[model samples]
Target: MNPINKVSQARVMSPILSGLIYAFVIMFAGTLFTSLILLLTSANESNLPAFSYINHIISLLVGGWVAGKKSGTKGWYYGGMLGCIYTLIIFMIAFLSFDAGLNGRSFLLLCVSLLSAGIGGIFGVNSRK
Candidate 1:
């Protein structure tokens, strides 16, 4: 393969990797902020779950958008794949660490993940000039 072609192919392959990195960074920041809020305020512990879902959704959306933008085509597909991969990773971690298993909630999360990322992907693609 031509050196230029190799470099370009590598660049194309990096969108998902970059998206995952960005998603984790965003999630970490959001979690840190949430933790600080919980520590500093009188927020009810019951709200923690809600905040976590919101954080994950937002993180995934942004991640999908980033992947879509980098891929510059089939944004929804790329974004959905990113979201699916992310969800699977999360599920595995929960399964291993918390003894969680596939259930109705897991299905719902998968749906939500796909939808959010798909929407973000559409937006990302359209946003490009």
Candidate 2:
């Protein structure tokens, strides 16, 4: 509430920024892994999607966990916020790029993303430094 306290808090790096960074990190790692697997394996096209989805969720989890750990406070809040931001961006891109239509299912996906991030945040907070 006080100006001094606010200033002190300002000195702290935003968890949102760190969370986004972690998300990118996870995304990159996922891409690399996927590429490697695709190159090495002769799996069916249908199976690739299953692997993709699993890695995608894992990446999301790791991103949220890193965000929570970096924040060192209000893990769920930060992680959920990160999820909301991430999902909104994705939604926007889909809407703009391909003129994709929104539906109830899309909304539900957002909810799932938020919940996943929040759960990962809890784990991050609980993990030992």
Q: What is the C-alpha RMSD of each candidate to the true structure, in Å?
A: 3.4, 4.8
- Highest TM-score: give the candidate number: 1
lDDT of 1: 0.84
Model 2's number of clashes is 0
Candidate 2, residue 58: how far the Cα is off, in Å: 1.6
Best by lDDT: 1
**Where is model 1 more than 4 Å wrong at Cα?**
1-13
* Local accuracy by lDDT, each model: 0.84, 0.75
- Tens-digit per-residue lDDT, 8-125, candidate 1: 3357457677778888899899999999999999998899978888888898889888888888888898789888988999899999999999998798889888888777777777
In model 1, state the lDDT of residue 103.
94
lDDT of 1 at 8: 36
Residue 36 error, candidate 1, Å: 1.1
